[model samples]
Target: MSNIGNYIKLLRESKNYSQRKLSLISKVSNATINRVESGISMPDPDTLKKLAPALGASYEKFMAIAGYLTGENSANNHNYTTGGNLLLKEEMEAIDLISHIKDKNLRTWITDPSSIDYIVFAKKLSDMGIDPDFVYNEFVSRIMKKNRE
Candidate 1:
């Protein structure tokens, strides 16, 4: 099977979703999901867009994996997490605070310090007396709005 197909299958199983369940939630046909997972076909941008949220991943990440993006652009687009010495103390603290959130996409975005979402999230957390839960909810709201656009 193709690398992207394996990646999707791993993520789907991690979420405990069957192919039919993923299809139902993602609004992609079961045949499409089967084709993707079986490495019979590659998903296009629109298909990946539909599947991303349902699979708890970002469309850019899927795009990168599907070879839709290339070179430095792909590196810039994908939200690959940087850890260890790369994380600032505030970033570490923010990650810890957000650990309770169940949204995998949000968690992935927040973990990548280079992501604009993480920058905005870190700035919000720096505000005195600001509630972490409120920040998380706001980010969730923003993500929902973005997905609609």
Candidate 2:
């Protein structure tokens, strides 16, 4: 299955939202939603962003879905918990950090289960000056530490 389809499925299931319900919430046509979910059509960035919030997800999530659709699994999985509050600053910082990492391998590792401490990961990226290789190594190191703990 294409990444877009996988993501659409994941987000839809996670939120317990039907495609028609998501269509209504996103103001997108149900056919469009179905097309995206089925990998028949890829939505533009703007349309994807609009649908994300309705799925109770963020733009990053939509980007991940896009990446998945493109057969690229370079999506960050930062399990950020703000307790129903959106931390705009932190989110922006994270977006900046992710943008800096141009390597797909590094990005995939950073977003994988092995490197889930998003706050620490972001801080490390900031401190290390956004070097993808360094960030990848640090992510591995952090994962090892967590496993040992």
What candidate 2 gets wrong by more than 4 Å, as runs, is 68-149
Candidate number with greatest lDDT: 1
lDDT of 2 by residue, 35-94 (tens): 877778887888877887786656755665464323333322332233333233344344
TM-score of 2: 0.45
Model 1 clash pairs are: none
RMSD of each: 11.6, 11.4
**Would you give me the overall lDDT of model 1?**
0.68
Residues 1-149 of candidate 1: C-alpha lDDT, one tens digit per residue: 55567557656765778999999999999999899878899998999999988987667666766778777776554553333122233543443355455777765554443563556455767676677677878989999999999
